[model samples]
Target: MNFLVFVKQVPDTETKIQIAGDGKSIVEDGVNFIVSPYDEIAIEEALLQKEALGGEITVATMGPNRGEAALRTALAMGCDKAVHLEDDAFEGADSYATAKALAAVVKKLNPDLIFLGKQGVGTDNTQVGQMVAEMAGLGHIGMCVKLEIDGDKIRGEREIEGGRETIEVSLPAVVVAQKGLNEPRYPALRGIMQAKRKPIEKLTVADLGLSADEVGAAGSKTEFARLEMPPAREAGKKLEVEPEVAAKEIVAFLKNEAKAL
Candidate 1:
């Protein structure tokens, strides 16, 4: 069995986001970037599968040159290979365009199983994995919390609106990992040193047989009209009155000021 995991680089969740001058992007300067937390879970799941099934794991990502750092981190966590899908044309790509590029690689690699995060942190569109599965003409299971591989099929337990559902899909399918899938492992000192020596393969739009207009901003189906900071929240009012009075005041605020009733 061969495993391919897709990872994404995102702004650190703790980093303060600032709208760029163009109002369609963020200011990258002085901001720390990390692998999307969900993607980290996907990588760990791939490693676990490789350990039990006896195969090589290849981790891939589509982003700027900086995205190689995410691949290196995956490699340091015991993945056997890394691929960086980088091109200037990939800039400003939406989930649709991004999935097209990723699906192309999936087709070329023809891995037995593919893994991806259920959603990227910054955008949270939750569309790329299913799109890639569609474009690749493969079965997909999303939001999987438990996965068991049996004979040429996999059984997965996934979360739903208020409960869990079980699904079974054959090999050569895509699995989108949700939180609670597994705890991600940190890169060890020995593995980190090994990662420094491993080479990362790079691919481009042209290499994937994709035209410039079929990906990136030109291929994006949606556009951001404007971007701005959210309004500041008002400080809460503390009540020192009697319990009954406080309850009455809270109800009044909710009905009249909050308008949530």
Candidate 2:
């Protein structure tokens, strides 16, 4: 079996973020980058799948040159190969365009199964995985937490809004994984050494035979005009009273002021 895992680079949530002057984009300075944590879990699941089913784990990602860091991290975690789809024209893609680019990369790889994170923190849209599946004309299962292979089919456990659901799907499918699928493996010395020797295929927009109108801001049907922070929370005043009265006051405050009740 050939398995392809889609990975993405995102701002480390630990870092502070600033919106750019344009308002639609983030300010890059001082923002640390790392693989999307959800994708990291997907990569771990792919590795585990490969270990049991016996296949090469391949990773694909799109971004600026710095995006290679995510691929390298995947390699260190035991992925056999990687492909980096990079271009300046790829900046600010909407979900459709992002899916188009990713589907194109997956076609070039021609894997039997595709693994993707349930969501990328960068956008948090939860749209790309399903969009990619639609673009590729493949079966898609979203929010999968547990996956088991049976012959050419896969059975999975997924989280729905209020509960979990089990599903069975045929092969050559796309799966978006949630956390708890598998614990990601730390990069081991041997894996890191192996990763250093593994080959990574690098492609640009020209390599994929796509034009700017097909993948970048031009291709995106949606546009981000501006983004602003929400209004700040006002400070609360402390209330002083006897214990019983204070308790009643607090309950009243919760019901009226906080509206949490």
Candidate 3:
């Protein structure tokens, strides 16, 4: 019952993002970073599984050195260990490259079950989990709202467009957790203190036997040509008249300005 959970560090949802001068990335300065909210749900699900099945939890993340903060938070939340994949060669990695790196690490760990969020809040790609599963040659189920493990098989209920679907897969599978799986728990003070003493293993692309050309921006199949802020919203108009007159005016405005009629 070895559980491996993948987490990501993303800017706080409330933070205002500013594009970097290179027009390919965001400015990191003064940006508050936290574990991706959906990943927190995955972590909570992993913790629940560990509690029920008596297994160890290992949380991993791929990012710059600053990502260690997110890993420590996962540790504080109850993961037994952490792994940080950090290297300049991994910079500007898209979903495919990220999945390649993570799959390599997963191969080294060989956990019985892998957990991930449905998508990353930062990129919102919703592609990495399936890519990792494919690269690792493991069965995968995505958007799982409920998960259960029995014997050597795992059953999950996943959300669909208008309904939910139940999927059953064998062991050594990957599960992408969706919202409503479970509420994530806050790290306790004692747990936070203990996390400070936990060992965090750091690895680089070379250590994973991957080449620079196979990851980072070089490996990205898509490129961002430019970045810009969305246009500002226009001011609204107000109407002041008798109720009946206002009703008529609204209909006329809709017909002429809004064109809804």
Better of 1 and 2 by TM-score: 1
Native-to-model Cα distance after best TM-score fit, residue 43 in candidate 3, in Å: 0.6
Model 2 C-alpha lDDT versus the unseen true structure: 0.89
How many pairs of residues in model 1 come into backbone collision? 0
Candidate that would win on TM-score: 1
Show model 3 residue runs off by greater than 4 Å. 239-261
lDDT of 3 by residue, 1-261 (tens): 899999999999998989999986889899999999999999999999999999999999999999999999999999999999999999888899999999998899999999999998978999999999999999988999999999999999999999999999998999999999999999999999999999899999998999998988888887778878879999877878799999998899999999999
> Which residue ranges in model 2 land beyond 4 Å of their true spot?
238-246, 258-261
Kindly list the per-residue Cα lDDT of model 1 for residues 1-261, writing each as its tens digit. Answer: 999999999999999999999998899999899999999999999999988989989899999999999999999999999989999999899999999999999988999999999998999899999999999999988999999999799999999999999989999999999999999999999999999998899999999999999999899998888888999998988879999999999999999999999
Pairs in clash, predicted candidate 3? none
Q: What's the ranking of the predictions by TM-score, best on top?
A: 1, 2, 3
Q: Could you give me the TM-score of model 3 versus the true structure? A: 0.92
Candidate lDDT values, in order: 0.93, 0.89, 0.93
TM-score quality measure for candidate 2: 0.93
Worst 10 residues of 2 by lDDT: 15-24
